[model samples]
Target: MSSSLIFTFIFTLCLLSSCFSSSASLHNATDENVTLRPQHEIQKLKLIREHLQKINKPTVKTIQDPKHGHWWLQFGSGTLVGYWPVSLFTHLMEHGNMVQFGGEIVNTKPGGSHTSTQMGSGHFAGEGFGKASYFRNLEMVDWDNTLIPTANLRVLADHPNCYDIRGGVNRVWGNYFYYGGPGKNSKCP
Candidate 1:
């Protein structure tokens, strides 16, 4: 065979092999025995939701910049405690969905800037920075292997207790498995 033809054949083989490998990995990951079995996954998700029952759902005052739509959620009103660990935690998938949920709110619209509350247990809303990238057949977990973090009494004004979260971007996405921050005022060690 000509050298060019041989090179093309090798390249095609490599591409096909890589695609098969990726597909197999996805298959294995979704086998129900991957993260937690059906019952266990449900249990973990339920426990995470249960944490919200304890929260008072304090509606801290919100500030929005008129020009850029920069929103600042003020959480210094009181000592609100919950089970949200400032790290990776299990966000359950939608019923019968393939992709699991993470803590990412994206603004797909170009130049989109607005804060909207997410659909979940707690009151979570943030301003959009950029686009979002999602992973398939992945699960989010917490520090203790439970769901959310517990014993978290955050004082947002302290700056130490709060974390400056930024995501929905191309390069960066979500908690990134605890590499993000406990904020400047966080008591985490």
Candidate 2:
């Protein structure tokens, strides 16, 4: 075969192989993505079981009257994170003008490891503002063990006045876990 023809044939083969490899990779990625959540949930459930065993606490398989909302705040160590429901914020906003919300630290893991503490505060505009003005403030310990604080404000004119807020900070680690969606699927280990 002519030199140019041979070169063209080799290039075409290479291009075809590259396309097939990319297609296979994409397919595998999609499959893995779908399976990851279920697997993680199972692992978290197992961890919860183990934790109960260690503490000699009864396994409460389910929570009653879970909370559902749009906004949230979460923080944790390792795989265990905290969450706060938006509904509670709304409820507090409705009843009071300047509100300070705080939680106590309850548990720590990896014994002897320093446990980080967090705090959140918020406020709302007074009645007849015709709407609620919301603001949130957060504080945490930095890597250098120094305290760092931040704040944010948001205004929502369409908040419903009569929605229920559920869920509370876990007594174990001050981590807030939300509920009322998808059974026990939204839990952390």
Candidate 3:
């Protein structure tokens, strides 16, 4: 419903996906019968238990709605994490008035000085392609729930010196944008 809630959901989903993938990669056994050392196995089990404990359990509950559909989030491994009824969002009942796709950063340091943290690719958007961070084949779901290309899209970057955004459309990428930069540079500071 609220933007902050939606952001939190997305942030949690990203964290879960990364954590699951990283933990799964710990299994190096090539064969089903491969056995690890006793100590190694214990350590692995402990690590997995800790990881599981750190994960936030989905707070969603099944709410049957014959009229409106539900929204779902899934992991990259094709695991269904959770689902919530669309009715929970008052603004999204009929259609969404606005949509946004971008990245953000937090200055962890206490002082006023900005931290030297990279936003996306650690390169300005003007660098393009392999050098800069980008989003491609952008599309939006209309009121009819049909996917359509974004139109009249406006790009905005808060701290242009620290991070910038550039939007474009091309035959290959369709509606795409290049963004992000190295933070805490001379110009940025």
Candidate 4:
């Protein structure tokens, strides 16, 4: 056979052999005994629904901003907190969302200043109040180049009191908070 034809044949054989080896390995590693538990799945679904309901359906209306995608839960005369990306805020406003009761997002700075610093949570430790354990900012563009928003929820396994939830445009700039346990504020460390 010509050198070029021989080389092509060898390459094709190598590719087919690799594919078969991968398939065989995958098949061999399959766990036939593993079964999904329906009860556990249902319980998880129920928990999620409960969480959603707490934050969404309230006796009052949720606040929304027309210019920027910031949402807030209003009470009495002041705004409790504002969420970026807007969708997560809307989700919290839905009936039967449990996340609504988790916490509120207080915009430390009114009128949405790009560089203004805001304080949240009644208690303060120096200047790091309301600082996110995982992220630094709320705009999705800051975390990623894309304008899309994402949400992250982390629950500490060892410490039942430690929990954090953040959602917004940038992973770096989002609303996040942690509470419960000894030295819970230092959990990010």
Candidate 5:
């Protein structure tokens, strides 16, 4: 396996271990036959598990309930990254419907000219595996509360000449995609 992939797996395992260990410590039987978490902790780990299952259900439409707050984690390291809370938009009665993956950048050049910028590895998707930027083992949570390979995945490139994306699946990578390119190329400009 690639070093980067091994590192990612180790990092993810560490984060999950930490989360589980902390939450598990809070689970204890009380004399009154009720196990309760601290008041400061509004939503415990159970809530997170329930939310994950609920969101994956086909009948469920909302992604988040404002009543139960949510945070996105940027786990760069054990301490460097933190949780970022999201505020609901006015139009979103309950939560968001669409989820997007990938990168976006604006062309600030005047006269509709392309800028000499690079996206992921500074190579086009056509450059193939090791030469291009890619994402691998992509999966989505299912109603069964288990992770499943992404289905009906879509790929799009606003400026194909400047940047592009190609999707594929394999036993090793599962649902994977190679993307990105050098901007302001002869074909792009």
Candidate 6:
């Protein structure tokens, strides 16, 4: 790991303890609609968006549902740094939004598309970018993290405790792991 990677792990490690204090499934807890509650995390989401935009300059979508009371911001439809794609970060953003908005993230596969959101299906399935359903992290589904030259650099920007929930076991697994999502599998140790 590089110095930056190590430093990032340390930063997110501080958030892990509080991120998973409760489990709020990305899918509905009981009904198909996962309840949405007011979140004090707009600042949190903004920080994430700012970091991605400043570093990669990918297109970002921001939405707030006061009726439902949540903020869903997603990034995708482009590449960042040629190797690392914004799609990878999109998944993590989805989870982070959930946690910030007071809900659990559904443990979708590392490369699976983001779907099964609180409002029935993810944003990707509805209209297009910014739909906010489980927003599809990638415009190109076939592309994998391997396409990125160094997973450590883009994915690990400032998050080290990240994990890929779909990886099955605990520990840093998969390139998605570097994204630092707020899922049980993605928590920092």
Candidate of highest lDDT: 3
Taking all chains together, the TM-score of candidate 4 against the true structure is: 0.17
lDDT per residue as tens, model 3, 29-118: 235564333234456445444433443322221222336566555533335667677867755555555667778988866677777888
lDDT for model 4, please. Answer: 0.30
Q: Give the runs in model 5 whose Cα sits over 4 Å from its true position.
A: 1-68, 74-80, 86-96, 142-146
* CA-lDDT, candidates in order: 0.25, 0.25, 0.61, 0.30, 0.53, 0.27
Tens digits of per-residue lDDT, candidate 1, 45-123, equal 3433343233332223223223333323343343232322212212221111122222432334343433232212222
Candidate 5: pairs in clash? none
**How much is the lDDT of residue 51 in candidate 2?**
30
Model 6, total clashes:
9
Instruction: Give the worst 10-residue stretch by lDDT in candidate 6.
Output: 1-10
lDDT of 6 by residue, 39-104 (tens): 445533443334333333123333322334233343444322122233434343222321111113
Candidate 1 vs candidate 5: which has greater lDDT? Answer: 5
Which regions in candidate 1 have their CA more than 4 angstroms from the true location? 1-39, 63-71, 76-189
Off by over 4 Å in 6: 1-39, 56-178, 181-189
| Runs with alpha carbons beyond 4 Å of true place in candidate 3 | 1-68, 74-81
- What overall lDDT, based on C-alpha atoms, would model 2 receive against the true structure? 0.25
Residue-wise C-alpha lDDT for candidate 4, range 103-135, written one tens digit per residue: 223333344432122112223222232222222
Question: Per-residue lDDT for 13-95 in model 5, tens only?
Answer: 12323544544434332245555443333344353334333322122111222344432232222222432234424433333
Clashing pairs in 1: 85-149, 89-141, 160-184, 160-185, 160-186, 161-185
lDDT of residue 144 for candidate 5: 32
Tell me the lDDT of candidate 5.
Answer: 0.53
Q: How much is 153 displaced in model 1, in angstroms?
A: 31
